[model samples]
Target: MVIVGSTNPAKLEPVRRVFAEVFGGLEVRGVEVPSGVRVQPIGYEETFTGAHNRAKGALRTPGASWGLGLEAGVEFNDLGAWLFNVAVVLREDGRTGVARGGSVLLPPAVGERVRAGEELGPVMDELVGQKDTKKGPGAVGILTLARVERVEFWRHTLELALPPFLRPELYPLE
Candidate 1:
């Protein structure tokens, strides 16, 4: 079975779809878990740490053969603040894989709020006048006019992380 770290539908549904597509017939379940990082992780390193921590925590579940963690965060560079996601997959025997999702440039106003210490989900909710936007189409979907849904966006990243599992001979546990 595959255990996902977050109970959020946005995270769980994509993991379910991607794992089903790649591994076939695996049971997938979500369990709420602490990320061990700031609620709004600001940079790539911090975001990756959160994903890694959650994956490790989920792996401790008794029947989990694989643990999956997905985390989204924003990063500021000279150009602008970009929002992105990271996925970490951990196997029971300690083999692991990690991949990052594509980033979308946040609108200046949204970036400002996030930079000022607001979590992106709430900021997005306030901007879009909707509740729990993160668990649905997400900022990318909103910004891209549904050109990419949250599930599709995350599925690509999660699928990228599976190469290590698919070809274990090439990706020896490290």
Candidate 2:
């Protein structure tokens, strides 16, 4: 069984799809867990930390054979602000694999608000005039006009992180 740290459908569904394909016949469940970081993680470090913490928290789920944590954050650079997601998978034996999702440059308006202190979810909701955008298509989806939903965006990250688990001989556990 696999326990996902967040109950958001965007995060939950993708993990379920990927795990079913990678480790056939396994069960995936989403459990709400605090990221233990800022509501809007600022940069790569904070985002990765949030994901790592979630994976650790997932260990508490009863009968969980593996834990999956997905976190998205924004980084402001000279050009503009870019949004990216990190995926972390933790196995019972202490092995872990991490991969990052593709990033998209946020428009100036959204980027400025995120830089100031607002969470991306709310900013995106207002921009899209929707209620809970985070639970469905996220910033990437709205910005891309639904060309990429959150599940598809996250699926790429989860798949990238699976190579290590699939070929343990190539990626030896320390």
For model 2, residues 1-174, the per-residue Cα lDDT tens digits are 899999899999998888888788988888888999999999999999999889888867899989888999999899999999999999999789999889999999999999999999999999878999998889999999889888999999999988889988899898
Pairs of residues clashing in candidate 2: none
lDDT value, residue 166 of candidate 2: 91
TM-score of 1: 0.97
* Shift in Å, residue 28, candidate 2: 0.6
Question: Candidate 1: where are CA atoms >4 Å away?
Answer: none
Q: Relative to the true structure, how large is the alpha-carbon lDDT of every model?
A: 0.92, 0.91
What TM-score would each prediction reach against the true structure? 0.97, 0.98
By summed lDDT, the worst window of 10 consecutive residues in model 1 runs over 14-23
